[model samples]
Structures are given as C-alpha cells and as structure tokens.
Target chain A: AQSVTQPDIHITVSEGASLELRCNYSYGATPYLFWYVQSPGQGLQLLLKYFSGDTLVQGIKGFEAEFKRSQSSFNLRKPSVHWSDAAEYFCAVGHFNKFYFGSGTKLNVKP
Target chain B: DTAVSQTPKYLVTQMGNDKSIKCEQNLGHDTMYWYKQDSKKFLKIMFSYNNKELIINETVPNRFSPKSPDKAHLNLHINSLELGDSAVYFCASSQRTSGSIGEQFFGPGTRLTVL
Candidate 1:
C-alpha cells in the first residue's frame, strides 16, 4: 500500500536557524508530492507541490521542498525560521484521485 | 474569497446523534474530498468524489456517509456519532487532468466534539 511517513513527531528550532523536516513515501508510480502546514486552530495551507519538472519547489512563507525520486523522499526546508513558522507540517502523496498524508511533524520555534 | 469552505466551524454533540457537515468549493475543481484529523493530529483521508462520482472510499465506518450533490459540493453525514468520532473534519477540492494532478484547496475545517 502507498503511504507517507514523517519521521519527526516534534522538532524544536531556534528562531533564525535553518530547518529541515524529513518525509519519505512508498508508491509504485511517479508520485505527486505536496507539503502542507497547519497552525493551531486553523485549517491546512498548501506550502508547495511537486508534480513534475523541477525537484526544488518553493512555497509560501519562505518554505521550499526538494523531491528526490531515488531516495523516495520529499523534504521541506527553510534557510531561516521565524516564530510564526511554529506549526504542524504534513507530507502528502497524490495518486489518481486519492491523497495519502503523513502523520505530521510539529515544529516549535524558540525565540 | 475562500476557495473551499465548510459549514459549522465547531460542533459539539452527544453520542448516537446524527449530524452533517457541508462543503463547497468555488474553484470549479472536478474533485472533492473529506479528511479527518484525530486529537493527535494524524490526518487520514475518508472519502473522495470526482465530478459527483465516488472515486475513493477509505476504511471509514458505514455510519459516515458522504453525499455529493454536485461537483462543487460535498457533504458528510454521520449516524450514531460515537465519542471516538471526535475530531476535526476538513473539506478539500482539486482538479484532475492528464498533465498534472492539481493541488488541493482546504477549508477552515469543522471541529467535531462528540461526548
């Protein structure tokens, strides 16, 4: 079965420090990758997506993700983190009309 | 304007009660979906409809039934709501094409609390 895995359940990063959240997926075909962020008491917001072409996809709020097919990974990163960046991040794989989301990783940004 | 919207931002109900959540999208997408987020924040897909046709149905209980009156609207009705059904439900929409599978647009979500 196709699934998405986000290894870190929770991560703490100092404001202004670089950040990286790992994601791995298991699928048979070329997967459509996506990153979504959810703030406390809020709905999910799409960060970025990778359908084809460029491996490095940039998203809103200074977020970017790189899709590595060989490693079956699509990791989200930011050169510098902000206090507002504290939230839960999810990785999803889209197949046909269905979507599979990872458990999610919570990021805590410290001032 | 919100591309996707859900009604009843928060709902508190008792077990055995029946309730429904409505969803609509203005993006004119061809597909709609329902997802449940548990207290632990684990997200899972429950159902999907493409152009008002059921395309994907996860292992959700039969008590949870989805109705798509049209391509732009999808509603979920839960019968005999259980305490375990307390969670945030989100509505999303996307456009499916041969070139690319469009990114999904999510609503603000409806937090359901069944006591």
Candidate 2:
C-alpha cells in the first residue's frame, strides 16, 4: 500500500532556532506532496505543496519543502522557529485526487 | 467568513447510536472530501465527492454513509457508532479541474466522542 512516513514522532526545538521535519513516501509514480499544520483547537491548514515542475516550493508561515524524487522524500524546513509554530505537522502524498497522509510529527518549541 | 463550515463542533453519543454531521462549502470548488483524524492526529481520507459524484472511497466501514445533496454540501451519517468511530471528522473542498497541483481547502473539524 502507498503510505507516507515521518521518522520522528516528536521533535523539540528552541525558539529562534532552525527546524527541520523529515518526511518520506512510497509511491509508484511521481507523487504530489503536501505539508499541513494543525494547531491546538484549530483546523489543519496547508503550508505548502509540491506537484511538479520545481523541486523546491515555498509556502505560507515562512516554511518551505523540497521534493527529492531519488530519495522519495519531501522534508520541511524553517530558518527560525517561532513559539506559535508549535503544532502537529503532517506530510501527505497523492496523485490526481487520492491522498495518503503520514502519521504526523508533533513539534514543540521551548523558550 | 469561513469558506468551509461544519455543524455540531462536538458530539457525544452512546454506543449503537446513529448520528449525522453536516458540512458545507462556499468556495465554489468542484470537489469535496471527508477525512477522519484519529487520536494520534493522523488525518486519513475517508470519502470524496466531485460535483456530487463519488470519486474516492477509502477503506472505511459500511456503517458510515456519506450523502451529498448538492455540490456545496456533503454530510456523513454513521449508524451503530462504535468505539473505534470516535475521532475528529473534517470536511474539505478542492478544485479538481485545476490544471496541476490541486489545492484543498478544509473546514473546521467535528469532534465526535462515544461513551
């Protein structure tokens, strides 16, 4: 079955420090990758997505992800983490209209 | 205004009870979807409708029934709710006709708790 994997279950980063979340997928063809963030008591919001064309895509909230086809990975990164960035991040892969999401990684930003 | 909205933000029911959650979107998109987020915050696609036509149906139990009266509305009805059914349900819409990267707009989820 096609699935997305997030190696780290929980990650803690200090405020103003750099942050990176790992994401990998298993798919047969070129996959459409997406990154979403879910804050406490809030709905999931789209951070960025990679479909085709460029390998690197920038999204809202100063976040970006690079789609590496050879490694089958699309990792998210931020130069400086904010306290509000503490949320559950999900990596999803799909083609056309179908989607498969990773279990998710919870990021905790400590001062 | 909220583009996509769901009713009954929180629901509590007993086992074997039947309930329904309603979702509506004003995005004017061609496709709508239903997703379930478990306790672990893992979001999984359950069903999807494009212009009132069923498009994607994942591995969900038969007890869960989805109804779409119009392109703007998609509702989920569950019969004989089980403990496993307890989770947060989200409704999303997307422009399926878009050329390449189809972006989805999601609504505030409906959290269901079974006692």
Candidate 3:
C-alpha cells in the first residue's frame, strides 16, 4: 500500500539552530507531496508542496522541501529555527484528492 | 478569509452516543474530504467526495458516514462512537477533479472524545 514515513518521532533543537526533518514515501506513481505544521489546538497549515517541475519548493514561514524521486524522499528544512517553530510537523502524499499523512515529528525547542 | 471551517471544535460524548461534525468550505472547491487524526497524529483519509459523488471510501467502518449535500459542504456522522473513535476529525477541500494537484485546505478540526 502507498504510505508516507516520517522517521523522527521527536526532534529537539535550540533556538537559532538549523533544522531538517526527513520524509520518505512509497507509491506506485509519482505523488503530490506536501508538508504541514500543526500548532496546539489549531489546524494543519501547509508548509510547502512538490507537485512537479522544480524539485525544490518554497513555502510560508521560511520553510522549504526538496523532492528526490530516486530516494522517494521530500525532506523539509529551515535555515534558522525559532522557539515558535516547536510544533508537530507532518509529511503527506497526495493521490488524486486523497492524502496519506505520516506519523508526525514533534519538535521541541530548548532555551 | 477562512477557507475551511468546522463546527464544534471539541466534542465529548459517551461511547454509545451519536454525534455529527459539520464542515463548510468557502473556497468553492468541487472536492471535499474527511480525515481522521489518530493519537499518533497519523492523518488518514476517511472519505472523499467530488462533485457530490463518492470518490474514495477508505477502510473506514460503516458506522461513520459522510454526507455531501453540496460541493461546499461535507459533514461526518458517527454512530455508536467508540473510544477508538476519540480523535481529531478534520475537514479539507481541494480542486482535485480540476485536473490539477491543488493543495488541500484544512479546517481547525473537531476533537471528539468518546468516554
């Protein structure tokens, strides 16, 4: 079956540190990839997406994700991490209108 | 403007109770979806309706039914809610059938707690 995998269950980074979250997918066909962030008591906010064209995609909140077809990965990165960046991040693969989300990684910020 | 909205941000009911979560999208999308976020925060597609036609019905139980009265609205009704059903229900909409891979917009979600 098609699926998305987020390797890190919990990631901790100090303020001002650089961050990278890994995401790998398995599907029969090329899928539309997306990264979403969720704050406490809020909805899922799209961080970035990779539909086609250039593999590197930029998104809001200073986030970016690179799509690597060979590796079947779309990892998210942020140059500088802020305290507010401490939230749960989800990687999803879209097939048609339906989506499959990963287990999610909870980022904790250390002061 | 809010693209997708869901009513009853929080719902708490007994295991045998029945409840409904309403979703509305102002994005004028032809496709609406219902998703379940489990305790592990794994979001899974429960149902998808495109132009009022059922496009995808996941392995979800029949106790949970999705109704799309129109393109902009899709509601989820759960019968005999169980403790396993105690998770966040999200409403999302996208332009799936428009021959484009438009990213889906999600609602704030309705967290249902079955006691």
Q: Please write out the lDDT profile of model 1 over residues B46-89, one tens digit for every residue.
A: 99999899988999999999999999999999999999999999
Model 1 spans > 4 angstroms off? none
lDDT of 3 by residue, A23-63 (tens): 99999888899999999889999998888899999999999
Q: Native-vs-model 1 lDDT?
A: 0.95
Candidate 3's TM-score reads 0.96
iRMSD values, candidates in order? 1.6, 1.9, 1.4
What TM-score, computed on C-alpha atoms, does each candidate reach?
0.97, 0.96, 0.96
DockQ of all candidates, in order?
0.72, 0.60, 0.73
Question: DockQ-based ranking, best first?
Answer: 3, 1, 2
Ranked by TM-score from best down, the candidates are 1, 3, 2
Judging by TM-score, tell me the better candidate of 1 and 3.
1
* Backbone clashes under 3 angstroms, per model: 0, 0, 0
Interface RMSD of 2: 1.9
Top of the candidates by DockQ = 3
Q: In lDDT terms, how accurate is model 2?
A: 0.91
Please say which candidate is ahead in DockQ: 2 or 3.
3
